[model samples]
Target chain A: DTAVSQTPKYLVTQMGNDKSIKCEQNLGHDTMYWYKQDSKKFLKIMFSYNNKELIINETVPNRFSPKSPDKAHLNLHINSLELGDSAVYFCASSLKTDTQYFGPGTRLTVL
Target chain B: AQSVTQPDIHITVSEGASLELRCNYSYGATPYLFWYVQSPGQGLQLLLKYFSGDTLVQGIKGFEAEFKRSQSSFNLRKPSVHWSDAAEYFCAVVMTTDSWGKLQFGAGTQVVVTP
Candidate 1:
């Protein structure tokens, strides 16, 4: 069984379009996070939620927003997507201060 | 500010050869250290972690890492490498002071195994 899972394993959309990625974890974790991996493979944290509460928000553009409906789910929405937004988005979950489990990742491609 | 560094951007090893991946961190106190492996088109898998008590820790797939406080390093090692061992290796750390499990990751090292 999958521990953490993300929808739309691959997405391709034109620039200026809007898209969203959904994440869910079955590990009974209290915290969840979103990380972006660029084409160069450098990964950076975007947002983190603890028990459905926003805890960490990096210096990402306002066009990017994270919504946590519950402790088990965290979704990312992007508005007016740009070509530079093309990258792999990863979802992770963990207990507070504990090891994290990552999803397979959603590859986003903006044309 | 705390940061992690992976000196080698890429490494190539022959099957059955020994392998070593270097990692260093900059932090006032010893932070929680971890090593993760990301295969092609795959998610990250935790190889091992060192919270405390021991400087050397063993991980799955016959991998091991040694934490050296003096050197500010935690280098991963494997005695024999197999073709399946090739993957992107990342060194990450969680600052003990951080309440949330925010991980500071290094620029990963890409390992390529050849026969």
Candidate 2:
């Protein structure tokens, strides 16, 4: 039983294409987060949701949207994906003031 | 305005040698520190964390970190480096003022272990 899991481990699409990544956590946490790791392996927070309520929204492009259907799931959708959007996206979940658990990343490649 | 710094971009060490990765944070209040490791093409895994109580904290995989409030540093140390220990290490801090616990991560340091 994985604590956190993501779908579509690898994604390859041309520029202007739209894509989505799904994440779910079995840990029953109230807070979830999305992070982007660029080619240089520098990770930055993108969005955070607590109990399906949006919390932290970093200075990310508007094309990237995070939707939380429930406390256990958080999905990211990229509209008109660009070359710069090609990177590894990670989903993490945690209790308030607790250590976060990350899921397997989804690597997006923009051709 | 808060930031985490990992001074070394890359480090090379021989197997069985000791390893130390330095981390420093810039925040006014008492900080919550963490160390995470990411293997090639893998997600990050928590190595250790320093919240309170003890200045020295032990973590999984035979790793330990010492937090020095005066220096604003929480450096990770491993007594013996193994080949599997070669990975990118990141230093992060949770802002005390933030209730959601948003983490500020460093640029990460790549460790190369030689046999």
Candidate 3:
């Protein structure tokens, strides 16, 4: 489809386990972003990649790393996930710094 | 630092009634403003955006927002609301020259519409 897509709509894992979420955008955009939405519905930016290069990193823990193999895809890997890591992660993409289109989001739960 | 504030955490409005959601922003310079609506279990959809133009901007679904530079506010309003309008509304802002222009969102307001 012509939209931002994310793998595993819902995720449940142990607190110490490692997990990865993949995101892809077919909008032919040059920039992609990752945002975290807490239980209170407060959305915050975590990272952003432009043309497969890191552009913005919001002081997220080193345990959280983002990899963009190509401009169309950006994947997030979390190491030693903690209870606080549980939240809905959304992937978005924009063209020429225009409107950002968001994916359905991946809900991560650390049990 | 740039920030967005949505004072009303929740609002209940009767169908066919006028609706307004408050949003305030704090930025060092002229910032880009946006209003997004998220339906139940769905990603956010842009209702409107204000970059640079007239102070009053018209958006989709009979929505309109007025940018008050003096007050540093961009408030969303609708003459009449529908039942399907019950959802969460978020106010966001981005720096004009920010790299990637990461959007900073407010805490969001849960809007409920009743018949």
Candidate 2 vs candidate 3: the TM-score winner is 2
Candidate 3 lDDT over A1-111, as tens digits, reads 649999989999999999999999998999999999998888999999999889999989999999999999999999999999999999999985788889999999999
Tens digits of per-residue lDDT, candidate 3, B84-113, equal: 999999999988987568898999999999
Error of 2 at A83 (Å): 0.5
Task: Order the numbered candidates by lDDT, best leading.
Answer: 1, 2, 3
Residue B81 in model 1: lDDT: 99
Per-residue CA lDDT of candidate 1, range B1-115, in tens? Answer: 7789999999999999999999999999999999999999999999999999889999999999999999999999999999999999999999999999788899999999999
lDDT value, residue B56 of candidate 3: 98
Lowest summed-lDDT stretch of 10 residues in model 1 chain B? B95-104
Off by over 4 Å in 1: none
Quality of candidate 2 docking, DockQ = 0.87
* lDDT score, candidate 1: 0.97
TM agreement with the true structure for every prediction: 0.99, 0.99, 0.97
Clashing pairs in 3: none
Candidate 2 Cα errors over 4 Å, as ranges:
none
